[model samples]
Target: MSRAAFYDQIETTLDQMRETGLWKPERLITSPQGARVQVDGAGEVLNFCANNYLGLADHPALVAAGTEAMGEYGYGMASVRFICGTLDAHRTLERAIADFLHTEDSITFAACFDANGAVFEPLLGADDAIVSDSLNHASIIDGVRLCKARRYRYETRNLADLDRQVAAARKERPGQVLIVTDGVFSMDGFVADLGPICEVADRYDALVMVDDCHATGFIGPGGRGTPALHGVEDRVDIVTSTLGKALGGGMGGFVAARQPLIDLLRQRARPYLFSNALAPALVGGAIEGLRLIAEGDDLRNRLEANAARFRSAMTDAGFTLTGEGHPIIPVMLGDADLAGRFAVRLLAEGVYATAFSFPVVPNGTARIRTQMNADHTDADLDVAVAAFTKVGQELGVVS
Candidate 1:
C-alpha cells in the first residue's frame, strides 16, 4: 500500500482498539510515587498500580543518595560504557547487584527489556536452542526472535511440558540448550517453580535463566529473588532483573550470571555497548537501595502483611483473584471493557488502580493488577478493599 493508505490503516486499527475498549490511557501523577499520590485530575488517591514494592520510590534515603551522587559525579555519562561511560558508580552498582544476587558478575543495561533483548543473540547461535515458558515476557519473546537459535516453548510453569520441550530440543542435538522463564509472572503474580525447573534443567543438561524483574529485591529471603526463595540460587545459571522495581524504583536493568557470561555480554550486548551509561544518581540510589533491601526484613514483613490483608479481604468479598504468596494481586475481570470501567469507578472511590487488557495480557484474562508496598498501612488496605467491594457490587461482579 502507498504511504497515505498505510497511515489510514493504522488510524483505523487505533479506532477499532478504542471502540473495543482495548485502549489504555495514562494517568498523570502530580506527586512522587508512594502509597498515596496526587493525581493531576483526580487529586490524592491510594495508589495500587505501581511496581514500587518496597515503597522506596520517594524514600528520603534514596533521594539523598541520588542527589549526593549527582553532585559528586555530575549528571549524565554522555557516552557508552566502552567509550568512557563506565563510571565508578556503575561498577559499584554492578558489584552490589552481583553480591546481592550471589552471582559471580553482572552487567547493566538501560532496562530489563534491553537486557533480555541483548542476552540471547550473544550467547546462543544457530546450533543452539532455547526452550521458553509460553507466558514469558514479551522481551524474552522478542529476544528469542532476534537469535538464530532454534526455539521451543512449553505451557506456562508446567514442568511436564518443559520436560517434553527440552527432550524435543535435545533431540535436535543442539550445541547448547537454555531454559528461560520469568521468576514472577507479573500479570498473574505467580512465582515460577524454580526448584523443579532446576531439576528439569539438570536432567536435560540445559542452562537455566530467569528474568526476575518483579521479584529481585523482595520475593525471596533477604530479597534475593525466586532462586533463593526456592533454595536453587546456585543452580540457576543466569538472572536478569530491573532496578526499576522495589530497588528504589528508579530505572535500570542488569544480567547477573557466571563470570564468563557477564564478560561476553559486556563485550557484545548491544544495549550496554550502545546506550549511555546509567545516570550517576540512579546508580548511587540503587546501591543504597540494595543496602536497604539487604537489611529490610521489617519492610518485607510489612509488605507481606499488606498483601495478605488485601488478598483475604478481596477474596472474602467475592472477587476472583489470581496469584498467592506474592505482592501482586490481579483482580480478574474477563471483559476488557468491564475491567476499564471498574478501574474508573475505583478512582472515584479514592483508590488509584489501572485496568489491564489484551496485548498486555491474554484477550479473556483482563484484570486490575494491584500491588502492595511496605508503606501501605492497615487503613490503606481497608480502603482499597472497600472500594473494590463497592465497585464489584455496583457492576454485578460480586453478590
Candidate 2:
C-alpha cells in the first residue's frame, strides 16, 4: 500500500472510533495530582480516576526527598544502570522495595510495563511453559508473547481452571512452568485469589509471578501488596509493581524476587539493560514513599472507609457496583456509549471519572472505574456520590 493509503486507513479507523463513542479524549490537569485538581477546561474537579491510592502523590515528605536527591545526584541518570547510571540512591530504593515486599532483592525499571516485559524472556526458554490467567494485564500478555515459552491460559481467578491448565502444562514435561496473574484486575477492580493460585503453583512445582501494579502501596497489610494480603508472600516467586501508582504517584517500576533471580535479570533482562535508569529524584521519592507506606495504617484505614462509604452510598442510590473491600470501585453502566456519556456528565457535575469500554473491559461490561484515596474526605465522597446519582438519573442508569 502507498503511504497515503496507510494514512487514510488510520484516519478511517479513527473516524469509526469517534462514531462508535470509543474515542477517549485526554483531559488536561493544571495542578499536581490529588483528590481535587485544577483542570484546564473543566476547572477544579474532584478526581476519582487517579491511581494515587495513598494520597502521597503530592505529599510534602516525598517532595522534600525528591528535591534533596535532585540536589545531590542531579536530575537524570543519562545512561543504563550497568553503564554509568547506577546511583547509590538507586541501590537504596531497590533495597527499600525488596524490604517492603519481603523479597531477597529487587531491580528497578523505567516502568512496570518494562519490568513485566523484562521478566519472562530471560528466565523461560522455548522448552518452558507459562500458564497465565486469561484476565492478566496486557503487559503480561505482551511479555509472554516476547518469550518463546509454551503458553497455557486459565479462566480468570479460577483455581480449578488453573489446576487443569498446570496439569496440562506438566504433560509437556517442560523445563519450567510459570503461573502469572495480576494482583488486581484494573477495569473490574477484582482482586485475584492469590492464596489459591499459590497452592496450585506448589502442587505443580511451578513458579508464580504477580503483577501488583494496582495493589502495591495500598492493598495489603502495611500496603505490602497482594502477597501479604493473601499471606502468600513467601509462596509467590516473583512480583512486578509500579511506582507510578500509590508509591509517590511518580514513575518507575521494579521486580522483587529471590537474590539469584534478580541477579540474572540484571544481566539479561532486555528492558532493564536497554532503558535509562530511573531518575534519582524518583528513586529518592520512592524511598520516602516506602517509609510512609510502612507507617501508614491510618492512611489505609481512611482509604478503606472512603471506598466503603462511596460504594455503599452508590449501591443504595440504585447503582450497580463491582469489587469489595478495596478502593477501586467500578460503577457498572453496561453500554459503552452510556459509560462515556456518564463520565462526561460526571465531569460537568464536578467529578472527574473515566469510562472503561471495549478493549479496556468487555463490550457489554463498560463502567466508570472510581478509585478512592486517602486524600479524599467524607465530604468529597458525598459530593462524588451526589454527582454520580444525578448523572445516573439523567442517563436513566438509576431511578
Candidate 3:
C-alpha cells in the first residue's frame, strides 16, 4: 500500500474514534507522582490518578537508594542478564523479592510485560491446557495468545465458570493445565476470588498463576499480595508483577516461583536472554521499595483507609463502584461521552482522575478510575468526593 493510503486509513479511524468519543489524548505530566501533582500547563491538581498506591513513588528512601546504586553499580546494564550484566545487586534484589513473596526463587525481567511474555511458550506446550480469567490484563492475554497450549477463557471472577473450565480441561487434556488470573482487575479494581479458584485448581490437579501487578505493595495484610490475602500464599505456582507501578514506580518486572521454575526461566525465557538487563538504579530502588513496603504498614494502612472512605462516600452518595477493598477504585460512568466529559470537568475543577471507556474496558462500562494513596489526606479526599458528586449530579449520573 502507498504511504498516502496508509495515512488515509489511520486518519479515517482517528475520525471514527473522535465521532464516538473514543480517541485518547495523552496528558503531559510536569511533576513527580504524589497527591498534589502539577500537570504540564495546569497548576497543582489533586491527583486521584496514578498507580502510586502506597504513595512511595517519590519517597526519600527510594530516591536515596536509586542515587546510591548509581555510584555503586553504575547506570545501565548494557548486556542481557546472561552476558556480563547480572550483578551482586541483581542477585540480592531477586532474593529479596522471593523472600517477600515467600517463594522459592525469583527472576527479573525488563518489565512485567516481558515477564508474562517469557512464561507462556516455554512452560506450556501444545499438549497442555490453559484456563484463564476473561478479565486478565492485556499482557496475560497476549502471552496466552503467543503460547501453543490449548487455551480457554472463563468469566471474570465467576468461580463456577472457572470450575467448569477446569472440569472440561481435565476431561479433555488429562494432565498439564494452568489457571491464570490477575490478582486484581485494574479497570474495575475487582479482586480475584483466589481461594475458590485455588480449590478448583487443586481439585482439577491444575497449577495456578496470577499477575499481581496491581495487588502487590497495596493489598493483603502487609502487602504480601493476593495469594496471601486468600490464604493461598504457597498454593500458587507462579506470581508475576511490575516494579513500574507500585514497587519502585520506576521500571522493572519479576516472576517468583519455585527454584526450578525460576531456574528454567533464567535459562530459556527469551526476554531474560535477549533484552538488556534492568538498570542498576531501578533494581536498587526496587530493593528499598520492597523493604519499605515490608515495614510500611503505616503507609499501606492509610491507603486502605482512604480507599474505604472513598468507596463508602461514593456508595452513600448513590454511586455504584465495582471493586473490593483495594485502592484501585473505579467510579462507574457507563457512557463514553459522559466519562470523557466527566474527566475533562474533573480536570477543570482540579481533580486528576481519568475516564476508562471502550477498549480499555468493555463498551458501556465507562468509569472514572480513581486511585488512592497514603499521602491523600481526608480533606483532599473530601474535595475529590464533593467534586465528583457535583459533576455526577450535574451530568445526571446521580440523584
Candidate 4:
C-alpha cells in the first residue's frame, strides 16, 4: 500500500477526475466482438467504439486460417525473434505487408505500439533531428522522445506552420531532418496531404515516414494508404500500421519500408530485440487478410459506402462532422460532461460509442467518436443515426 510516497495523490487525482466527469469504468462484454455486441447487464448494442473498420475479425476464412496455424505452430512463440520465434509464418506476414504497401521489405512487431517504439532511436541519433506533426499519435511522440535526436513539431497539416517549422530547423540546427505524420489523423478524420508534405520534405532533403494506422485499408486505390491516395506512394519511405485495425482484429503490427531501413530496424530496434514475437496463428491470419486485399477488397468498398452514407445523413440532420470521406466520424458536443452523457444515452438506445475529452482530445472540444465497419448494413446505420439524432437534440447538440 505504501509502495511510493505519492500514492495518496493517485487516489486524490482519481477523485478529482470523477468530479470532473473524466473518470471511466469499462463495461463487461457478454458476446463476441462484432457489428453488434451484448453487454453483461444490457441488451444487444451496436458497436461503434471499435477500430474494426473492415469487419474481418469474425470472417470464416480468417478464422479457418488462424485455427489451422494454431494446429501447425502451437500457441506461443515463448521467445523473441532473435531466438527460435522467427517462424516462416512471421516472415511471410512481413513479406505480405511489404507487397500490400508496395514497399521493398517489412518487419513485424507485437503491436504497432512497439513498432514505433523500436523505429526512431535505432534510425536516428542526437546529432540528427525529427520533425513531427503536432497531433501525431502518442506512439510516435514516445518513439521520438526515446531517441536522443533533437525534436521539432509542425502544426498538424498546416502548410504555413510546416514551412515555419522547416525554416526554423534549417536556420537553427542543420542536420539530417526527418518528417513524421499520421496518414490519417485518428481524432479528426483528416488525412495528411502527403503530396505537399513530400514536396516540402524533398525541398529540405529530409526523410519521410507516415503512420498509416487509420488509412491503410480504405484511403487509396485498392486501399494502399494515404500516400497512394495523394499520388506519392513512392515518396513515403517508411510506414507503420496495425493488423488489429483493418487487416485482422487480433494483435500485431508492422513496419514497411525499403530494404536498408528494414535491415537497420531488424539489427537494432530495442523492442524487436527484447519482445516475444507475434503469435503464429495471428501472423498466418494476417497473411490471409493481406491476400484478400490484393485479390479484391470488397470489404474496403463497403466501408467507403458506409462512411459516405453516415456522414451525409448526419450532416443533413444538423450534426457537425469533422473532415469528409473517412470512416472515423466525430460528433462534436463541446462539453466533456455532455459528451459522456450523450454516450450513455446512445448506449441505452442500443448504440455503442465512446466519448473523447481532455488529454485524449482538447478540453472544450469533447466529442463522441464513431467508427464505421464494412459489415454495418444500411439498416444498421439508419438505426444508429436515428439514435444519434435523438440524443443530440435532447442534449442540445443539434436542432
Clashing pairs in 4: none
Q: What is the alpha-carbon lDDT of model 2 when measured against the actual structure?
A: 0.92
Q: Per-residue lDDT tens digits of candidate 1, residues 316-339?
A: 999999998999999999998899
* Pairs of residues clashing in candidate 1: none
lDDT of 1 at 107: 95
Ranking by lDDT: 1, 2, 3, 4
Can you write out model 2's per-residue Cα lDDT over 248-349, one digit (the tens) per residue?
A: 889998999999999999999999988899998899999999998898598888898899899899989999999877889999989988998899889999
The candidate maximizing lDDT is 1
Model 4 lDDT at residue 36? 92
Worst lDDT run of 10 residues, candidate 4, spans 166-175
lDDT of each: 0.94, 0.92, 0.90, 0.88
C-alpha positional error of residue 276 in candidate 2 after TM-score superposition, expressed in Å: 0.6
lDDT of candidate 4 over 100-174, digit per residue (tens): 889999999988999998899998887788889999999999999999889999889997788777767766665
Question: Would you estimate the TM-scores of all the predictions?
Answer: 0.98, 0.98, 0.97, 0.97
Task: Please identify which of the two predictions, 1 or 4, would achieve the higher lDDT against the true structure.
Answer: 1
Query: Lowest summed lDDT over 10 consecutive residues: which window, candidate 1?
Result: 18-27
Clash pairs (backbone) in predicted model 2: none
lDDT of 3 by residue, 187-289 (tens): 9888898999999999988999999999888778788899999999989999999998878588988999999899988998988999999998898899999
